[model samples]
Target: MIEHATHQKIALITGANKGIGRAAAEQLAALGMTVLIGARDPRRGEEAAAALRAAGGNAHQVTLDVTDQATARAAAQQIDERFGHLDVLINNAGITGSGQVSPEDAHDQVPSSVNLDMVRAVFETNVFGVIAVTNAMLPLLRRSPAPRIVNVSSAAGSLTIASDPDGPLTGLPTSAAYTPSKTALNALTVQYANELRKNGFLVNAADPGYVDTEINNHSGYLTVAQGAAALVRLATLGADGPTGGFFSEDGPVPW
Candidate 1:
C-alpha cells in the first residue's frame, strides 16, 4: 500500500459541493492530497474548496456534471492539461426515486400511474452518469502510479439483502429508481475493475449506510461524515488494497 499522496495524488470527487462527497473531499484534502471539488454548481464548488482550504486542506474546484458528457470530457481535458494526470476519482453523485414504492405495490408505479420521467432522471444521475464520468476520466486516471476509483453507493443496492426472505432491507423494500441504479453501479464496478486491474487501477463500490443528508431528506440516522468513512478508505487505499468489491462501514457487504 502506497497511499502517501506526497507524490501529488490528485483526487476528484463528483457531487462534492455537499454531503458525504464533501466530507470525503475534506478528509482527503486534509491528508495532503490535492482535492478537486467537482460539482455542477461552480459557486458551490468554489465555496466548498474555500472552506476546505480555510481548514488547512489543499483544495480546488471543477465544474462537473456527471450526467453531462460534454462537461465530463472537458473536465478530464482540464485535469490532464493542468495536473498531467489524476490519481483518484470518486463517483459520489447520485439521486433517489420518489417515495418508496414496493415491488408488490407496482400498481402505484404503473407505466401510466407513476412518473416515468422521474425514474429516468434518477437513473441519469445515479447509474449512467457514473459510467459516463469514469469512462471520460480514465485516460487521466491511467497515467497515475496508483489509481483508485470509489463509487459512493448505498446498501439499498444490495439485491442479496433487499431480496432475502428475512432481511433488514425489507423495511426499504420498494423502488421506482435509485436502488436499481446502485445495483447497476455495483455491477459496473466489477467490469471496470476487471479491465483496469491489469492497468494497476483499483475500482470498487462502497455503501455509505443510510447517512443523514439532503439525498435522504435528512431522515437517516448517520451523519454525512460517518457515511463518508468507507468512501474515504476506498479512495485512499494503498496499492495492495481490495478492488472490484463492495464494502460498508462494518466491513465487506454481500452482493
Candidate 2:
C-alpha cells in the first residue's frame, strides 16, 4: 500500500482536476510526493485522486476554489488537520477570459474595444486567485523543511517576447485580458519569491508552452504532459534552483 505519512512531502495543486494542473499533480505523485488534487468541483477532485491512487500514487482530493476565499481557507485547514504541513503549492488555476470568442478571433481581447469585465474576470482568477490561495496556505507551507510554489504563466506574458518586433507574437492582435493577467502573475511570482527566499521558499513562474487544453480549444501544439514538465521540474527543484524567475521546458524565459 502507498504510504500517506507526514514524512512524505505533500503537494497541493490548485485546479488539479484536469489539464496542466492535473498533469502536474500526476507527475508529482509519481515522484513520491503525497499529492493533494485541489479542485473546485468535489466530484472531479475525487475522481482525479482516485485515478492517481489506482495508478499506485498517493493522492487525495481537496475541495478548493481559487477564486473563493472560503474554499481556499477550508482547503488549507483541511490540509493542516491531515498532514500538518505542505511542501509544495502549485497555483495552476487560470482562465483566458475569452468567453464566446473563438480561438481564431483575437479581436475580443484587443486593447481598445475589449470588454472591461472580461479583463477583471481574468485578473480575478489568473492573478488574484493565486494570491488568495497562496496566502491561505502560507502557514502550512511554512512548516515544511523546503517549500516551493510554481505559478503557471504563459509566453504571451513575457514582456520581452511581446515587445520584440521579430518575436512570435509580432502580428498577433494585442491582448488586453488573458495576456495581461499572466504578466501580472509573473510579477507576483517575483515578489513572492523575494519575500520568502530567506525563509527557504522557491517561488517561480512557468510557461507551459501552448498545450492543447480547454483554454485554447485544443489548438496548441504541445500535449498536457509536455506542458506540465516545467511546472513539475520547478516544483521538485533542489535547494540551489533559481527563484523569482520564469522558465519553460527548454530553459530560462526572459521577463
Candidate 3:
C-alpha cells in the first residue's frame, strides 16, 4: 500500500468553516495530508483552521468562494505555490436556497411556487461554482500521482429516489431549487470523472446522509463527523479505487 502522506498529499475542502466540510478537513489532516479549509468568510476560515490546529491537525485557511472566478483562480494559484499539487478537491460548499431565504416558510416554498430566481441563485453556487473551482484547480490536481475529487452531493438529488413515490425522499416536497441543483452536480461529476480518469484522477460524488447542520436546522440524526465519513473515504481512495461513481456511507447511490 502506498503511504498516505509519503507523497505529501494536499487537500482543499470548500465551505469548510463548519459542519461536514470542517469535519472532513480534520480527518484528512489527521491522516497527514495538509487540509485547506476553503471558506467564503476569512475570519471563520481562520477560526476553523485554528481550532483544527489546536486539535493537532495540519489545517490552514483558503479564501474560496466557488462562485467567484477571481477567487477561484487565486486559490488555485496559492495552492500551486505552496503545495505544488492538489491530491484531493472536495466540493463541499452548498446551500439550501429556500431554507436560507425564508426560514419561517413551509416546505411548500418549493415545487410549483418555488421562486425561479432562487433556483437560479442556488444553481450559481452549487452547479456553476463547482465547475469554476474545479477547472481553476485542475492544473495542480493533474500534477498529483493519484488525484481525487469528491463532490458533496445529497440523496435528494437522486432522480431514482425522487421519482419513486414509495421511496423515503418522497416525504420531502420542497425540492425544486436545492435538489435539482445537486442533480446537475451529480451529472457533472460523472462527466468530469470520465474525462479525468485517463490522467489517473478519481472523481466521484458523495452523499453524506443528511447530517444535522445549520442547513437542516439540526433536525438530522447524524452528526457532522458521521456525515463526513463517506466523503473522507471517497477522498482518500487509492489509484485503483472506483471512479465515476456516486456513493454514500452504505455504498453506491442511484443516479
Better candidate by TM-score, 1 or 2: 2
The digit string of per-residue lDDT tens for model 3 on 1-255 reads: 332335788899999999999999989988888899999999999999999999998888999999899999999988877777888999999988855456554344467777666777789999999999999999989888889999999999999998898898866665788889999999999999999889998999999997999898899999999999999999999777999999999999999
Error of 2 at 210 (Å): 1.4
Best by lDDT: 2
Question: Taking the tens digit of each residue's C-alpha lDDT, what string does model 1 give over 89-157?
Answer: 999988665543345433343344566766777788888899899999898888889999999877778
- Give the distance in Å from residue 39's predicted Cα in candidate 3 to where it truly belongs: 0.4
- Runs of candidate 2 exceeding 4 Å displacement: 1-6, 100-107
What lDDT does the true structure give each of the candidates? Answer: 0.86, 0.92, 0.90
lDDT of model number 3:
0.90
RMSD of each: 4.4, 2.6, 3.2
For model 1, what is the alpha-carbon lDDT of residue 33?
91
Q: Give the deviation of candidate 3 from the true structure as CA RMSD.
A: 3.2
Q: Report the error of model 1 at residue 234, Å.
A: 0.6
- Please estimate how well model 1 matches the true structure, expressed as its whole-model Cα lDDT: 0.86
Name the lDDT value of residue 51 in candidate 3: 96
